[model samples]
Target: MSQRPTQRCHDYVQEVFAQEDEILRTVRQQTAAHGMPQISLEPNEAKLLQLLVRLCSAERVIEVGALAGYSGICIARALPERGRLITIELSSLHADVARAHFKLAGLADKVTVRQGAGMEVLPTLAADGPYDLMFIDADKGNYANYLDWAAENLRLGGAVVADNAFWGGSIFNPQTDDDQAMVAFNRKLAAHPQFDSTIIEVGDGIALGVKTK
Candidate 1:
Protein backbone atom coordinates (compact mmCIF):
# COMPACT_ATOMS: atom_id res chain seq x y z
CA MET A 1 0.00 0.00 0.00
CA SER A 2 1.23 3.43 -0.84
CA GLN A 3 0.67 6.25 1.64
CA ARG A 4 0.56 9.74 0.21
CA PRO A 5 1.34 12.44 2.75
CA THR A 6 -0.43 15.24 0.93
CA GLN A 7 -3.57 13.17 0.52
CA ARG A 8 -3.45 12.29 4.21
CA CYS A 9 -3.09 15.91 5.16
CA HIS A 10 -5.96 16.85 2.89
CA ASP A 11 -8.19 14.25 4.47
CA TYR A 12 -7.21 15.47 7.92
CA VAL A 13 -8.06 19.02 7.01
CA GLN A 14 -11.41 17.97 5.61
CA GLU A 15 -12.14 15.97 8.74
CA VAL A 16 -11.07 18.55 11.29
CA PHE A 17 -11.44 21.97 9.69
CA ALA A 18 -13.71 21.78 6.63
CA GLN A 19 -16.55 19.35 6.76
CA GLU A 20 -19.05 19.45 3.86
CA ASP A 21 -22.69 18.55 4.04
CA GLU A 22 -25.00 16.82 1.58
CA ILE A 23 -25.70 20.01 -0.33
CA LEU A 24 -22.05 20.52 -1.18
CA ARG A 25 -21.63 16.88 -2.07
CA THR A 26 -24.59 17.06 -4.41
CA VAL A 27 -23.15 20.16 -6.03
CA ARG A 28 -19.89 18.36 -6.64
CA GLN A 29 -21.64 15.36 -8.12
CA GLN A 30 -23.77 17.53 -10.33
CA THR A 31 -20.81 19.38 -11.71
CA ALA A 32 -19.01 16.17 -12.46
CA ALA A 33 -22.09 14.67 -14.03
CA HIS A 34 -22.41 17.70 -16.26
CA GLY A 35 -18.83 17.32 -17.47
CA MET A 36 -17.60 20.48 -15.85
CA PRO A 37 -13.94 20.63 -14.94
CA GLN A 38 -13.04 19.43 -11.45
CA ILE A 39 -11.46 22.63 -10.34
CA SER A 40 -13.63 23.80 -7.51
CA LEU A 41 -11.93 25.02 -4.38
CA GLU A 42 -11.09 22.53 -1.67
CA PRO A 43 -13.35 22.25 1.37
CA ASN A 44 -10.95 24.23 3.54
CA GLU A 45 -10.69 26.94 0.94
CA ALA A 46 -14.45 27.16 0.67
CA LYS A 47 -14.68 27.56 4.43
CA LEU A 48 -12.04 30.24 4.32
CA LEU A 49 -14.10 32.15 1.76
CA GLN A 50 -17.08 31.98 4.08
CA LEU A 51 -14.96 33.29 6.91
CA LEU A 52 -13.58 36.10 4.76
CA VAL A 53 -17.08 37.15 3.76
CA ARG A 54 -18.07 37.33 7.40
CA LEU A 55 -14.86 39.06 8.36
CA CYS A 56 -15.47 41.73 5.77
CA SER A 57 -19.19 42.03 6.46
CA ALA A 58 -19.77 41.57 2.73
CA GLU A 59 -23.36 42.12 1.63
CA ARG A 60 -22.76 42.68 -2.06
CA VAL A 61 -20.45 40.13 -3.64
CA ILE A 62 -19.31 39.26 -7.13
CA GLU A 63 -17.80 35.99 -8.26
CA VAL A 64 -15.93 35.98 -11.58
CA GLY A 65 -16.33 32.29 -12.14
CA ALA A 66 -19.33 30.14 -11.29
CA LEU A 67 -18.35 26.70 -12.53
CA ALA A 68 -21.12 24.68 -10.91
CA GLY A 69 -22.30 26.88 -8.09
CA TYR A 70 -19.95 25.29 -5.56
CA SER A 71 -18.06 28.47 -4.75
CA GLY A 72 -21.16 30.53 -5.37
CA ILE A 73 -23.09 28.53 -2.81
CA CYS A 74 -20.22 28.61 -0.37
CA ILE A 75 -20.03 32.37 -0.51
CA ALA A 76 -23.80 32.85 -0.67
CA ARG A 77 -24.29 30.72 2.43
CA ALA A 78 -22.18 33.20 4.32
CA LEU A 79 -24.39 36.13 3.41
CA PRO A 80 -27.10 37.66 5.56
CA GLU A 81 -30.69 37.16 4.38
CA ARG A 82 -30.69 40.25 2.19
CA GLY A 83 -27.21 39.91 0.80
CA ARG A 84 -26.73 39.26 -2.93
CA LEU A 85 -24.13 37.40 -4.97
CA ILE A 86 -23.66 37.91 -8.70
CA THR A 87 -21.63 35.22 -10.39
CA ILE A 88 -20.39 35.28 -13.98
CA GLU A 89 -19.67 32.26 -16.15
CA LEU A 90 -18.36 31.87 -19.68
CA SER A 91 -20.26 28.71 -20.45
CA SER A 92 -24.01 28.74 -20.68
CA LEU A 93 -24.11 25.05 -19.86
CA HIS A 94 -22.17 25.65 -16.66
CA ALA A 95 -24.39 28.59 -15.89
CA ASP A 96 -27.46 26.39 -16.19
CA VAL A 97 -25.96 23.80 -13.88
CA ALA A 98 -25.07 26.46 -11.37
CA ARG A 99 -28.55 27.97 -11.43
CA ALA A 100 -30.10 24.58 -10.75
CA HIS A 101 -27.72 23.99 -7.87
CA PHE A 102 -28.49 27.40 -6.45
CA LYS A 103 -32.19 26.53 -6.57
CA LEU A 104 -31.55 23.24 -4.83
CA ALA A 105 -29.54 25.01 -2.17
CA GLY A 106 -32.40 27.50 -1.74
CA LEU A 107 -30.08 30.30 -2.83
CA ALA A 108 -31.78 31.06 -6.11
CA ASP A 109 -32.82 34.42 -4.82
CA LYS A 110 -29.47 35.28 -3.41
CA VAL A 111 -27.35 34.22 -6.39
CA THR A 112 -27.57 35.57 -9.92
CA VAL A 113 -25.78 33.62 -12.63
CA ARG A 114 -24.69 35.67 -15.61
CA GLN A 115 -23.53 33.83 -18.69
CA GLY A 116 -20.91 35.73 -20.73
CA ALA A 117 -17.27 36.55 -20.96
CA GLY A 118 -16.37 38.27 -17.70
CA MET A 119 -14.73 41.33 -19.19
CA GLU A 120 -17.76 42.07 -21.33
CA VAL A 121 -20.27 41.42 -18.58
CA LEU A 122 -18.43 43.18 -15.78
CA PRO A 123 -18.93 46.60 -17.25
CA THR A 124 -22.71 46.15 -17.19
CA LEU A 125 -22.44 45.46 -13.46
CA ALA A 126 -20.86 48.78 -12.69
CA ALA A 127 -24.08 50.33 -11.43
CA ASP A 128 -24.43 47.49 -8.95
CA GLY A 129 -21.83 49.53 -7.24
CA PRO A 130 -19.01 49.44 -4.88
CA TYR A 131 -19.26 45.78 -3.98
CA ASP A 132 -18.09 44.58 -0.57
CA LEU A 133 -16.10 41.66 -1.93
CA MET A 134 -15.08 40.31 -5.33
CA PHE A 135 -13.83 36.76 -5.84
CA ILE A 136 -11.85 36.12 -9.04
CA ASP A 137 -11.59 32.53 -10.21
CA ALA A 138 -12.01 32.88 -13.94
CA ASP A 139 -9.57 32.40 -16.82
CA LYS A 140 -6.06 33.03 -15.54
CA GLY A 141 -5.28 35.27 -18.49
CA ASN A 142 -7.84 37.79 -17.28
CA TYR A 143 -7.05 37.71 -13.59
CA ALA A 144 -5.22 41.00 -13.65
CA ASN A 145 -7.98 42.62 -15.67
CA TYR A 146 -10.47 41.46 -13.09
CA LEU A 147 -8.33 43.07 -10.44
CA ASP A 148 -8.46 46.28 -12.38
CA TRP A 149 -12.24 46.19 -12.31
CA ALA A 150 -12.29 45.29 -8.63
CA ALA A 151 -10.01 48.17 -7.86
CA GLU A 152 -12.40 50.52 -9.56
CA ASN A 153 -15.66 48.95 -8.41
CA LEU A 154 -15.01 47.82 -4.85
CA ARG A 155 -15.49 50.33 -2.10
CA LEU A 156 -12.70 51.52 0.13
CA GLY A 157 -11.72 48.69 2.47
CA GLY A 158 -13.50 46.16 0.23
CA ALA A 159 -11.58 43.01 -0.68
CA VAL A 160 -10.62 41.24 -3.89
CA VAL A 161 -9.87 37.55 -3.40
CA ALA A 162 -8.29 35.67 -6.33
CA ASP A 163 -8.03 31.89 -6.50
CA ASN A 164 -5.41 29.80 -8.34
CA ALA A 165 -2.74 32.36 -7.71
CA PHE A 166 0.04 29.79 -7.72
CA TRP A 167 -1.17 28.18 -10.96
CA GLY A 168 -0.21 24.76 -9.71
CA GLY A 169 3.25 25.92 -8.59
CA SER A 170 4.02 27.52 -11.93
CA ILE A 171 4.58 30.94 -10.41
CA PHE A 172 8.27 30.19 -9.98
CA ASN A 173 8.85 29.31 -13.63
CA PRO A 174 5.78 29.80 -15.75
CA GLN A 175 5.84 27.71 -18.93
CA THR A 176 2.36 28.34 -20.31
CA ASP A 177 0.42 31.49 -21.05
CA ASP A 178 -1.94 30.96 -18.12
CA ASP A 179 0.94 30.38 -15.74
CA GLN A 180 2.72 33.46 -17.00
CA ALA A 181 -0.47 35.45 -16.56
CA MET A 182 -0.75 34.32 -12.96
CA VAL A 183 2.82 35.35 -12.28
CA ALA A 184 2.08 38.76 -13.67
CA PHE A 185 -1.13 39.00 -11.63
CA ASN A 186 0.71 38.10 -8.42
CA ARG A 187 3.39 40.70 -8.99
CA LYS A 188 0.85 43.36 -9.93
CA LEU A 189 -1.14 42.87 -6.77
CA ALA A 190 1.86 42.69 -4.46
CA ALA A 191 3.35 45.94 -5.77
CA HIS A 192 0.20 48.01 -6.32
CA PRO A 193 0.24 50.96 -3.91
CA GLN A 194 -3.52 51.40 -3.57
CA PHE A 195 -4.19 47.96 -2.17
CA ASP A 196 -2.73 45.95 0.68
CA SER A 197 -2.41 42.31 -0.33
CA THR A 198 -1.22 38.88 0.73
CA ILE A 199 -1.19 35.44 -0.84
CA ILE A 200 -2.62 32.70 1.36
CA GLU A 201 -1.13 29.26 0.91
CA VAL A 202 -4.40 27.43 0.51
CA GLY A 203 -5.69 24.94 -2.07
CA ASP A 204 -3.64 26.20 -5.03
CA GLY A 205 -3.15 29.69 -3.56
CA ILE A 206 -5.42 32.64 -2.90
CA ALA A 207 -4.41 36.26 -3.39
CA LEU A 208 -6.31 38.67 -1.16
CA GLY A 209 -6.21 42.41 -1.69
CA VAL A 210 -7.94 45.12 0.26
CA LYS A 211 -8.41 48.55 -1.29
CA THR A 212 -6.92 51.14 1.05
CA LYS A 213 -7.53 54.36 -0.82
Candidate 2:
Protein backbone atom coordinates (compact mmCIF):
# COMPACT_ATOMS: atom_id res chain seq x y z
CA MET A 1 0.00 0.00 0.00
CA SER A 2 1.35 3.40 -0.95
CA GLN A 3 1.24 6.03 1.77
CA ARG A 4 0.90 9.62 0.71
CA PRO A 5 1.78 12.57 2.89
CA THR A 6 -1.02 14.37 4.67
CA GLN A 7 -1.18 18.15 4.79
CA ARG A 8 -0.13 18.05 8.42
CA CYS A 9 2.81 15.85 7.57
CA HIS A 10 3.82 18.24 4.86
CA ASP A 11 3.56 21.17 7.26
CA TYR A 12 5.73 19.35 9.75
CA VAL A 13 8.36 18.64 7.18
CA GLN A 14 8.38 22.26 6.04
CA GLU A 15 8.63 23.52 9.55
CA VAL A 16 11.43 21.18 10.48
CA PHE A 17 13.37 20.58 7.33
CA ALA A 18 12.43 23.32 4.88
CA GLN A 19 12.24 26.57 6.73
CA GLU A 20 13.13 29.50 4.48
CA ASP A 21 15.85 31.90 5.53
CA GLU A 22 15.72 35.65 5.02
CA ILE A 23 17.60 35.47 1.73
CA LEU A 24 15.34 32.78 0.24
CA ARG A 25 12.21 34.54 1.48
CA THR A 26 13.39 37.74 -0.14
CA VAL A 27 14.07 35.96 -3.41
CA ARG A 28 10.57 34.51 -3.52
CA GLN A 29 8.90 37.79 -2.57
CA GLN A 30 10.99 39.94 -4.90
CA THR A 31 10.36 37.64 -7.82
CA ALA A 32 6.62 38.15 -7.37
CA ALA A 33 7.09 41.89 -6.91
CA HIS A 34 8.99 41.97 -10.20
CA GLY A 35 5.91 40.43 -11.89
CA MET A 36 7.72 37.22 -12.71
CA PRO A 37 5.93 33.89 -12.49
CA GLN A 38 5.82 32.66 -8.91
CA ILE A 39 6.62 29.15 -10.02
CA SER A 40 9.96 28.49 -8.36
CA LEU A 41 10.35 25.47 -6.15
CA GLU A 42 8.72 25.43 -2.73
CA PRO A 43 10.83 25.33 0.42
CA ASN A 44 10.43 21.58 0.73
CA GLU A 45 11.44 21.05 -2.85
CA ALA A 46 14.38 23.42 -2.46
CA LYS A 47 15.52 21.44 0.55
CA LEU A 48 15.23 18.27 -1.46
CA LEU A 49 17.37 19.80 -4.21
CA GLN A 50 20.00 20.63 -1.62
CA LEU A 51 19.82 17.11 -0.27
CA LEU A 52 20.21 15.65 -3.72
CA VAL A 53 23.25 17.81 -4.41
CA ARG A 54 24.90 16.79 -1.17
CA LEU A 55 23.89 13.17 -1.64
CA CYS A 56 25.58 13.05 -4.99
CA SER A 57 28.48 15.21 -3.83
CA ALA A 58 27.80 17.42 -6.78
CA GLU A 59 30.37 20.16 -7.34
CA ARG A 60 29.64 21.13 -10.92
CA VAL A 61 25.95 21.77 -11.52
CA ILE A 62 23.79 22.94 -14.39
CA GLU A 63 20.34 24.34 -13.83
CA VAL A 64 18.14 24.55 -16.95
CA GLY A 65 15.96 27.24 -15.41
CA ALA A 66 16.92 30.16 -13.19
CA LEU A 67 13.67 31.69 -12.01
CA ALA A 68 14.68 34.37 -9.51
CA GLY A 69 17.53 32.09 -8.32
CA TYR A 70 15.48 30.47 -5.59
CA SER A 71 16.47 26.94 -6.52
CA GLY A 72 19.93 28.05 -7.60
CA ILE A 73 20.60 29.35 -4.09
CA CYS A 74 19.63 26.02 -2.62
CA ILE A 75 21.77 24.08 -5.03
CA ALA A 76 24.73 26.40 -4.58
CA ARG A 77 24.54 26.26 -0.82
CA ALA A 78 24.95 22.52 -0.90
CA LEU A 79 28.05 22.69 -3.03
CA PRO A 80 31.59 22.82 -1.71
CA GLU A 81 33.60 26.04 -1.70
CA ARG A 82 35.07 25.26 -5.11
CA GLY A 83 31.72 24.27 -6.61
CA ARG A 84 30.16 26.08 -9.56
CA LEU A 85 26.66 26.39 -10.99
CA ILE A 86 25.59 27.48 -14.46
CA THR A 87 21.92 28.44 -14.65
CA ILE A 88 20.01 29.27 -17.83
CA GLU A 89 17.02 31.56 -18.27
CA LEU A 90 15.29 32.64 -21.45
CA SER A 91 14.12 36.03 -20.20
CA SER A 92 16.67 38.75 -19.63
CA LEU A 93 14.51 40.32 -16.96
CA HIS A 94 14.22 37.04 -15.12
CA ALA A 95 17.93 36.44 -15.55
CA ASP A 96 18.72 39.85 -14.08
CA VAL A 97 16.39 39.22 -11.20
CA ALA A 98 17.98 35.83 -10.55
CA ARG A 99 21.44 37.35 -10.65
CA ALA A 100 20.44 39.85 -7.99
CA HIS A 101 19.02 37.11 -5.85
CA PHE A 102 22.14 35.03 -6.25
CA LYS A 103 24.20 37.98 -5.12
CA LEU A 104 21.91 38.53 -2.17
CA ALA A 105 22.21 34.87 -1.26
CA GLY A 106 26.00 35.35 -1.23
CA LEU A 107 26.29 32.87 -4.07
CA ALA A 108 27.30 35.23 -6.86
CA ASP A 109 30.76 33.77 -7.05
CA LYS A 110 29.35 30.29 -7.36
CA VAL A 111 26.68 30.89 -10.02
CA THR A 112 26.67 32.05 -13.60
CA VAL A 113 23.31 33.14 -15.02
CA ARG A 114 23.26 32.44 -18.74
CA GLN A 115 20.53 34.39 -20.50
CA GLY A 116 19.27 32.25 -23.38
CA ALA A 117 16.91 29.47 -24.28
CA GLY A 118 17.85 26.12 -22.73
CA MET A 119 18.54 24.43 -26.04
CA GLU A 120 20.67 27.28 -27.24
CA VAL A 121 22.61 27.63 -24.00
CA LEU A 122 23.10 23.92 -23.36
CA PRO A 123 25.24 23.37 -26.42
CA THR A 124 27.54 26.22 -25.45
CA LEU A 125 28.00 24.57 -22.03
CA ALA A 126 29.26 21.15 -23.21
CA ALA A 127 32.92 22.03 -22.79
CA ASP A 128 32.30 22.78 -19.11
CA GLY A 129 31.24 19.23 -18.36
CA PRO A 130 30.89 16.38 -17.71
CA TYR A 131 28.83 18.05 -15.01
CA ASP A 132 28.08 16.40 -11.70
CA LEU A 133 24.39 17.31 -11.69
CA MET A 134 21.79 18.72 -14.04
CA PHE A 135 18.46 20.07 -12.83
CA ILE A 136 15.58 20.51 -15.31
CA ASP A 137 12.75 22.93 -14.60
CA ALA A 138 12.28 24.81 -17.83
CA ASP A 139 9.86 24.42 -20.75
CA LYS A 140 8.01 21.14 -20.44
CA GLY A 141 7.99 20.48 -24.16
CA ASN A 142 11.75 20.32 -24.28
CA TYR A 143 12.26 18.12 -21.23
CA ALA A 144 13.12 15.07 -23.27
CA ASN A 145 15.65 17.04 -25.23
CA TYR A 146 17.28 18.26 -22.03
CA LEU A 147 17.43 14.69 -20.73
CA ASP A 148 19.12 13.63 -23.94
CA TRP A 149 21.70 16.31 -23.38
CA ALA A 150 22.19 15.26 -19.77
CA ALA A 151 22.82 11.67 -20.82
CA GLU A 152 25.83 12.77 -22.83
CA ASN A 153 27.17 15.51 -20.58
CA LEU A 154 26.82 14.05 -17.11
CA ARG A 155 29.55 11.88 -15.67
CA LEU A 156 28.91 8.20 -15.09
CA GLY A 157 27.77 8.84 -11.50
CA GLY A 158 26.14 12.22 -12.04
CA ALA A 159 22.46 12.84 -11.55
CA VAL A 160 19.66 14.39 -13.59
CA VAL A 161 16.70 15.82 -11.70
CA ALA A 162 13.56 17.17 -13.36
CA ASP A 163 10.64 18.97 -11.76
CA ASN A 164 6.92 18.69 -12.62
CA ALA A 165 7.24 15.03 -13.40
CA PHE A 166 3.58 14.49 -12.53
CA TRP A 167 2.33 17.60 -14.39
CA GLY A 168 -0.32 18.07 -11.72
CA GLY A 169 -1.57 14.51 -12.08
CA SER A 170 -2.04 14.95 -15.82
CA ILE A 171 0.56 12.29 -16.57
CA PHE A 172 -2.00 9.62 -15.74
CA ASN A 173 -4.07 10.53 -18.81
CA PRO A 174 -2.13 12.98 -20.92
CA GLN A 175 -4.31 15.11 -23.21
CA THR A 176 -2.19 18.13 -24.04
CA ASP A 177 1.13 18.19 -25.82
CA ASP A 178 2.96 19.22 -22.65
CA ASP A 179 1.38 16.31 -20.82
CA GLN A 180 2.39 13.89 -23.52
CA ALA A 181 5.88 15.29 -23.53
CA MET A 182 6.20 14.80 -19.78
CA VAL A 183 4.94 11.23 -20.05
CA ALA A 184 7.42 10.49 -22.77
CA PHE A 185 10.23 12.09 -20.80
CA ASN A 186 9.38 10.08 -17.72
CA ARG A 187 9.20 6.83 -19.65
CA LYS A 188 12.49 7.52 -21.36
CA LEU A 189 14.24 8.37 -18.12
CA ALA A 190 12.93 5.23 -16.46
CA ALA A 191 13.95 2.96 -19.31
CA HIS A 192 17.33 4.52 -20.10
CA PRO A 193 19.96 1.77 -19.89
CA GLN A 194 22.70 3.86 -18.34
CA PHE A 195 20.70 5.37 -15.52
CA ASP A 196 18.89 4.15 -12.42
CA SER A 197 15.81 6.32 -11.97
CA THR A 198 12.86 6.89 -9.66
CA ILE A 199 10.17 9.46 -8.98
CA ILE A 200 10.07 10.97 -5.53
CA GLU A 201 6.62 12.12 -4.40
CA VAL A 202 7.71 15.63 -3.62
CA GLY A 203 6.05 18.87 -4.68
CA ASP A 204 4.71 18.23 -8.22
CA GLY A 205 6.92 15.14 -8.19
CA ILE A 206 10.67 15.07 -8.86
CA ALA A 207 12.13 12.56 -11.30
CA LEU A 208 15.71 11.65 -10.33
CA GLY A 209 18.11 9.56 -12.38
CA VAL A 210 21.71 8.67 -11.63
CA LYS A 211 23.99 7.66 -14.46
CA THR A 212 25.68 4.28 -13.99
CA LYS A 213 27.44 3.85 -17.28
Candidate 3:
Protein backbone atom coordinates (compact mmCIF):
# COMPACT_ATOMS: atom_id res chain seq x y z
CA MET A 1 0.00 0.00 0.00
CA SER A 2 1.18 3.48 -0.83
CA GLN A 3 1.85 5.66 2.17
CA ARG A 4 0.67 9.24 2.50
CA PRO A 5 3.30 11.91 2.03
CA THR A 6 3.31 12.80 5.70
CA GLN A 7 3.61 9.18 6.74
CA ARG A 8 6.32 8.57 4.16
CA CYS A 9 8.29 11.52 5.40
CA HIS A 10 7.75 10.53 9.00
CA ASP A 11 8.84 6.96 8.29
CA TYR A 12 11.93 8.16 6.50
CA VAL A 13 12.79 10.49 9.35
CA GLN A 14 12.38 7.67 11.83
CA GLU A 15 14.57 5.45 9.70
CA VAL A 16 17.31 8.02 9.41
CA PHE A 17 17.20 9.82 12.74
CA ALA A 18 15.09 8.07 15.37
CA GLN A 19 15.04 4.67 17.05
CA GLU A 20 12.35 3.17 19.29
CA ASP A 21 13.30 0.31 21.57
CA GLU A 22 11.29 -2.44 23.26
CA ILE A 23 10.76 -0.55 26.51
CA LEU A 24 8.96 2.26 24.74
CA ARG A 25 6.98 -0.20 22.68
CA THR A 26 5.80 -1.96 25.82
CA VAL A 27 4.90 1.33 27.42
CA ARG A 28 2.77 2.28 24.43
CA GLN A 29 1.02 -1.07 24.36
CA GLN A 30 0.37 -0.99 28.08
CA THR A 31 -1.20 2.44 27.87
CA ALA A 32 -3.70 1.18 25.33
CA ALA A 33 -4.39 -2.00 27.23
CA HIS A 34 -5.00 -0.03 30.41
CA GLY A 35 -7.46 2.28 28.64
CA MET A 36 -5.23 5.31 28.95
CA PRO A 37 -5.12 8.04 26.34
CA GLN A 38 -2.68 7.25 23.55
CA ILE A 39 -1.17 10.71 23.66
CA SER A 40 2.19 9.77 25.14
CA LEU A 41 4.24 11.44 22.42
CA GLU A 42 5.60 10.63 18.97
CA PRO A 43 8.80 8.61 18.70
CA ASN A 44 10.68 11.49 17.12
CA GLU A 45 9.42 13.82 19.78
CA ALA A 46 10.57 11.45 22.49
CA LYS A 47 13.97 11.31 20.85
CA LEU A 48 14.02 15.07 20.64
CA LEU A 49 13.30 15.31 24.36
CA GLN A 50 16.15 12.91 25.04
CA LEU A 51 18.44 14.95 22.86
CA LEU A 52 17.42 18.10 24.63
CA VAL A 53 18.16 16.50 27.98
CA ARG A 54 21.63 15.55 26.79
CA LEU A 55 22.23 18.90 25.16
CA CYS A 56 21.50 20.68 28.40
CA SER A 57 23.46 18.19 30.48
CA ALA A 58 20.37 17.99 32.61
CA GLU A 59 20.76 16.17 35.92
CA ARG A 60 17.35 16.94 37.37
CA VAL A 61 14.15 17.00 35.31
CA ILE A 62 10.60 17.97 36.17
CA GLU A 63 7.96 16.60 33.86
CA VAL A 64 4.41 17.92 33.99
CA GLY A 65 1.70 15.64 32.63
CA ALA A 66 3.14 12.19 32.48
CA LEU A 67 0.39 10.18 30.79
CA ALA A 68 1.87 6.71 31.24
CA GLY A 69 5.57 7.24 31.88
CA TYR A 70 6.47 6.96 28.19
CA SER A 71 7.94 10.43 28.05
CA GLY A 72 9.33 10.08 31.55
CA ILE A 73 11.18 6.95 30.46
CA CYS A 74 12.55 8.79 27.47
CA ILE A 75 13.81 11.57 29.72
CA ALA A 76 15.09 9.12 32.29
CA ARG A 77 16.94 7.14 29.65
CA ALA A 78 18.94 10.23 28.76
CA LEU A 79 19.85 11.04 32.31
CA PRO A 80 23.06 10.04 34.00
CA GLU A 81 23.03 7.17 36.44
CA ARG A 82 22.55 9.42 39.44
CA GLY A 83 20.18 11.86 37.76
CA ARG A 84 16.55 12.16 38.81
CA LEU A 85 13.16 12.78 37.23
CA ILE A 86 10.08 14.08 39.07
CA THR A 87 6.86 13.76 37.11
CA ILE A 88 3.41 15.13 37.99
CA GLU A 89 0.30 13.25 36.96
CA LEU A 90 -3.29 14.05 37.91
CA SER A 91 -4.81 10.67 37.29
CA SER A 92 -4.06 8.03 39.91
CA LEU A 93 -4.54 5.29 37.35
CA HIS A 94 -2.07 6.93 35.01
CA ALA A 95 0.36 7.46 37.85
CA ASP A 96 0.11 3.85 38.95
CA VAL A 97 0.69 2.59 35.43
CA ALA A 98 3.55 4.98 34.98
CA ARG A 99 5.15 3.80 38.21
CA ALA A 100 4.87 0.21 37.05
CA HIS A 101 6.41 1.07 33.71
CA PHE A 102 9.23 2.94 35.37
CA LYS A 103 9.89 -0.10 37.56
CA LEU A 104 9.81 -2.41 34.56
CA ALA A 105 12.27 -0.11 32.82
CA GLY A 106 14.49 -0.17 35.92
CA LEU A 107 13.93 3.54 36.39
CA ALA A 108 11.91 3.34 39.59
CA ASP A 109 14.89 4.42 41.62
CA LYS A 110 15.48 7.46 39.45
CA VAL A 111 11.94 8.59 38.74
CA THR A 112 9.36 9.97 41.18
CA VAL A 113 5.70 9.99 40.25
CA ARG A 114 3.79 12.73 42.03
CA GLN A 115 0.06 12.28 41.73
CA GLY A 116 -1.95 15.52 41.76
CA ALA A 117 -2.85 18.57 39.76
CA GLY A 118 0.29 19.99 38.22
CA MET A 119 -0.36 23.46 39.46
CA GLU A 120 -0.96 22.30 42.98
CA VAL A 121 1.97 19.94 43.00
CA LEU A 122 4.32 22.44 41.41
CA PRO A 123 4.51 24.69 44.44
CA THR A 124 5.69 21.82 46.62
CA LEU A 125 8.46 21.12 44.13
CA ALA A 126 9.88 24.59 44.62
CA ALA A 127 12.12 23.33 47.41
CA ASP A 128 13.51 20.78 44.98
CA GLY A 129 14.46 23.43 42.47
CA PRO A 130 16.26 24.79 40.70
CA TYR A 131 15.72 22.02 38.18
CA ASP A 132 17.85 21.56 35.10
CA LEU A 133 14.91 21.17 32.74
CA MET A 134 11.12 21.26 32.84
CA PHE A 135 8.95 19.47 30.29
CA ILE A 136 5.32 20.54 30.07
CA ASP A 137 2.64 18.51 28.25
CA ALA A 138 -0.40 18.82 30.47
CA ASP A 139 -3.69 20.64 30.20
CA LYS A 140 -3.48 23.25 27.45
CA GLY A 141 -5.21 25.86 29.55
CA ASN A 142 -2.44 25.67 32.12
CA TYR A 143 0.37 26.04 29.62
CA ALA A 144 1.10 29.58 30.63
CA ASN A 145 0.92 28.71 34.30
CA TYR A 146 3.35 25.85 33.83
CA LEU A 147 5.73 28.04 31.90
CA ASP A 148 5.52 30.62 34.61
CA TRP A 149 6.43 28.05 37.21
CA ALA A 150 9.31 26.84 35.05
CA ALA A 151 10.63 30.33 34.61
CA GLU A 152 10.78 30.81 38.33
CA ASN A 153 12.01 27.38 39.43
CA LEU A 154 14.48 26.41 36.70
CA ARG A 155 18.06 27.43 37.11
CA LEU A 156 19.38 30.43 35.23
CA GLY A 157 20.62 28.30 32.34
CA GLY A 158 17.94 25.63 32.48
CA ALA A 159 15.51 25.10 29.63
CA VAL A 160 11.74 24.77 29.50
CA VAL A 161 10.33 22.61 26.73
CA ALA A 162 6.62 22.23 26.09
CA ASP A 163 4.62 20.06 23.72
CA ASN A 164 1.35 20.86 21.89
CA ALA A 165 2.07 24.53 21.61
CA PHE A 166 0.19 24.82 18.31
CA TRP A 167 -3.02 23.41 19.79
CA GLY A 168 -3.75 21.33 16.68
CA GLY A 169 -3.68 24.41 14.43
CA SER A 170 -6.67 25.71 16.33
CA ILE A 171 -4.79 28.82 17.33
CA PHE A 172 -6.27 30.28 14.17
CA ASN A 173 -9.75 28.92 14.74
CA PRO A 174 -10.26 31.24 17.75
CA GLN A 175 -12.98 29.03 19.15
CA THR A 176 -11.41 26.43 21.37
CA ASP A 177 -10.53 27.47 24.90
CA ASP A 178 -7.39 25.43 24.61
CA ASP A 179 -6.43 27.22 21.41
CA GLN A 180 -6.90 30.57 23.08
CA ALA A 181 -4.80 29.51 26.04
CA MET A 182 -2.09 28.14 23.76
CA VAL A 183 -1.97 31.35 21.80
CA ALA A 184 -1.47 33.26 24.99
CA PHE A 185 1.13 30.79 26.22
CA ASN A 186 3.11 30.99 22.98
CA ARG A 187 3.12 34.75 23.04
CA LYS A 188 4.03 34.87 26.70
CA LEU A 189 6.82 32.35 26.31
CA ALA A 190 8.43 34.30 23.47
CA ALA A 191 7.95 37.64 25.15
CA HIS A 192 8.74 36.69 28.74
CA PRO A 193 11.80 38.68 29.76
CA GLN A 194 13.52 35.95 31.71
CA PHE A 195 13.60 33.47 28.83
CA ASP A 196 14.53 33.44 25.17
CA SER A 197 12.13 31.18 23.36
CA THR A 198 10.77 29.87 20.08
CA ILE A 199 8.24 27.29 18.96
CA ILE A 200 9.27 24.50 16.58
CA GLU A 201 7.10 22.34 14.37
CA VAL A 202 7.62 19.03 16.05
CA GLY A 203 4.80 16.64 16.75
CA ASP A 204 1.96 19.24 17.14
CA GLY A 205 4.41 21.95 18.12
CA ILE A 206 7.11 22.33 20.76
CA ALA A 207 8.04 25.48 22.62
CA LEU A 208 11.66 25.72 23.66
CA GLY A 209 12.85 28.36 26.09
CA VAL A 210 16.04 28.92 28.02
CA LYS A 211 16.19 30.87 31.23
CA THR A 212 18.57 33.70 30.49
CA LYS A 213 18.48 35.53 33.77
Candidate 3 residue spans exceeding 4 A from truth:
1-7
* Model 1 alpha-carbon drift over 4 Å, by segment: 1-10
Residue 26 in model 2: lDDT: 93
TM-score of each: 0.95, 0.98, 0.95
* TM-score, structure 3 vs. true: 0.95
Among all windows of ten consecutive residues in candidate 3, which has the lowest summed lDDT? 3-12
- lDDT by residue (109-153, candidate 3, tens digit) is 999999999999999999978999999999989989998899889
Q: Candidate 3 at 197: error in angstroms? A: 0.9
Worst 10 residues of 2 by lDDT: 1-10
lDDT of 2 by residue, 15-76 (tens): 99899999999998998899999999989989999999999899999999998999999999
After best superposition, candidate 3 residue 74: deviation in angstroms?
0.4
Highest lDDT: give the candidate number: 2
Model 2's number of clashes is 0
Instruction: Choose the strongest candidate by TM-score.
Output: 2
Give, for candidate 1, the lowest lDDT window spanning 10 residues.
3-12
Answer with 1 or 2, whichever has the higher lDDT: 2
Badly placed stretches (over 4 Å) of model 2 are none
